[model samples]
Target: MKHRKLISLAIVPILVATFIATTATLSLAGSSINPRLYGSDRYETSTAIANQFSNQTVSNVVLASGNDFPDALSASVLAHELSAPILLVDRNTQTSKAALDYIQAHLRPQGTVYITGGTSVIGSNFESLLSNQGHQIKRLGGSDLYDTNELIVNELNSTSDTVYIASGQNFPDALAISSFASQTNSPILLTQTNGLPKGAQEYLTNNEPKNIYIAGGTAVVSGSVENEIKSISPNSKITRFAGQTRFDTASLAYSQLAANPKTIYIASGLNYPDALSGTILAALNGDPILLIDPSTPLVPDSIAMYLAQLYKNGATPNVTALGGSVVVPDEVINNVVNLLNGQSQSPLFNITTVDSRLNFGGLPVNLLPNKTIGSTLTLTNTTIPIAVFIRR
Candidate 1:
């Protein structure tokens, strides 16, 4: 009976499963894929993002003006809520064929394609173009950016005791924090550098949040602007995370908001599109993003210090580099990897030899059920004895 027990046993199944897994693990660190997302241009990059994050079937898609960034910055919340992807379209050019192709191929949208801006930015004929392709259109816009932002906030149908305020004049700071705000259900209201715009003020008056967060320095959004906000909501606790530069501001903002996330997305500081599309994915994954200088090939010293600190505090150094090598250079990638691997430990523990697997896979044959023969096995921090049943 003992010899007969060996006949039905086969370690080959276990060996084959482990071998395949070990091969795949060779290119990975820990369980995270550490994906580098990029494309030839912004339009394609947005599509690539959808491909990675959205399932093959989706009902809605958010379309924003590719000619500018303000509209898209406020659109992330809607996208996140609808489980949709945001695709940018050139204002005069209408919807880019790549975006339409992505929708046709991946999304299979039987519902609405929400447009962020009105006719002036995306053209009046745009809605018809999408309708021709069989998508119902819902337009969200107003006379200007602030009005549009207010409308977006109203669309959310939800608010928090906290609100994030950023300048509508520029895109960097707002783009940097959009993901965080969306994830937390905090609407990002835009204001001019000198004063709070009427629509934005109305938004504050309507919501009456308890905590107001300013996302940029005085230069981008002045003290006068901050005071205007405080006047509207005098009882609210106001906090500012500003810095000498946009990069520093982003770092400070991330430090304040992200409580030790598993992944960090690195996007270009100089441009907006990559970060714009990347934010939705970042929010979905519960990751925070840091902006980098696109012109330089080396990692900035401040960013390196920040990453090193995160590692020291037991945060996994899994990073996703957005944009192409032209935008995020190869040297920066090497520096990031080196910094994460600096603790004299490999990010991935690979089972390189059969001897290692034999020692680890020493389990009783009875534990593995029938037909699980070629299944992968994972043992973590456990002392249970695993046998390798070999049939000779």
Candidate 2:
């Protein structure tokens, strides 16, 4: 028989277990992986996003209606071309006042402020407010959203042979391709579901771009429109980025257009304000803006899987959410965190025991149950001399 001494190691197990639980909690709730950029309202949120561009020299500012999305959908490329920030404003004097203040403070002296819509969307009073500040104001509004889009493209003065065509009826498809458009200095023209907008038709016929990328499926932009595009620009190579849903379309666009983004900005696909302003930031960083459905708690399966694969491939890009909790809730971020942690398809809470080996004075000891000691002992490498057990 071997003589053995009973050592009381009750405290070690409790401490180690507590540390593991706390660490797991922190890892799940940590904001380091996904930071949010939002405000109390859409107007203020655009301002909050604009603040991110403060470090850079922003000589031009693109102003669009916060209440509407059409005119602003195609402004990202123009904003990127001018090295400016896209700020959304409302007709409400109070809301527009804040944007004006931001412009006055941030805009370089004699900086040009480009307004996207006509007086109907963004009233002339707001234009007057911007002009009163001594900043040169250029209003790009046309007869309709399509014309406005064409005017914006013309302002780009881009000689690039690539052009993107997305639906004018909806906001998602255009925004899906906005960042890529900004990157290539390509113009994004809007067309009706069944026909091409006159302005877009004329522009395509005149410029005759070498490449035309159409966003969304036939449901939003029917085959008729594609045929019309072919008639107008026969030589242009047309590629369509469409999916069963808007989220899928956005994912497809990101995967095809942006090769390897250093950062990914996740925005609400149901709404347009956050993404409208965020596009400039994405373009400036040469990153991709991925749209997420806010109504669902979990991220779309396709996006979650793609992100998990990106992580597994050793690409750890910084992820940022674009709106407040109401727009993009914590549950969505939690799901994103799981994907980034390489646990997208795994169980939610994975509770497992740590190693049972104990390091005591440079010696490995296994915890054995003895009649004298009623408790089991397990250990990890810690300052404590005794063994410990950690279940996380």
Per-candidate Cα lDDT values, in order, are: 0.71, 0.75
All-Cα superposition RMSD per candidate: 15.3, 13.0
Q: Which stretches of candidate 1 lie over 4 Å from their true place?
A: 1-33, 92-95, 343-392
Give lDDT for model 2: 0.75
lDDT: worst 10-residue window of model 1: 17-26
lDDT of 1 at 294: 52
Judge candidate 2 at residue 167 and give its lDDT: 93
lDDT of 2 by residue, 124-176 (tens): 88767667777788999998888898888888879989999999999998988
**TM per model?**
0.77, 0.78
- Give the clash count for each candidate: 5, 2
Q: List model 1 lDDT by residue over 1-392, tens digit each.
A: 32211122233344322221122221224525455787788887777777777758788888887778887789987888878888877775444876777777765645788899888888767687778777788899988888888888888856567889998989888977888887877889988899898878987888789888898999889999888888889888998888788877877777777758767787888888888887788887557777887544445665666667766766664677887766765445555655554432222222222223333366524222233443575555646222232322
TM-score, cand. 1 = 0.77
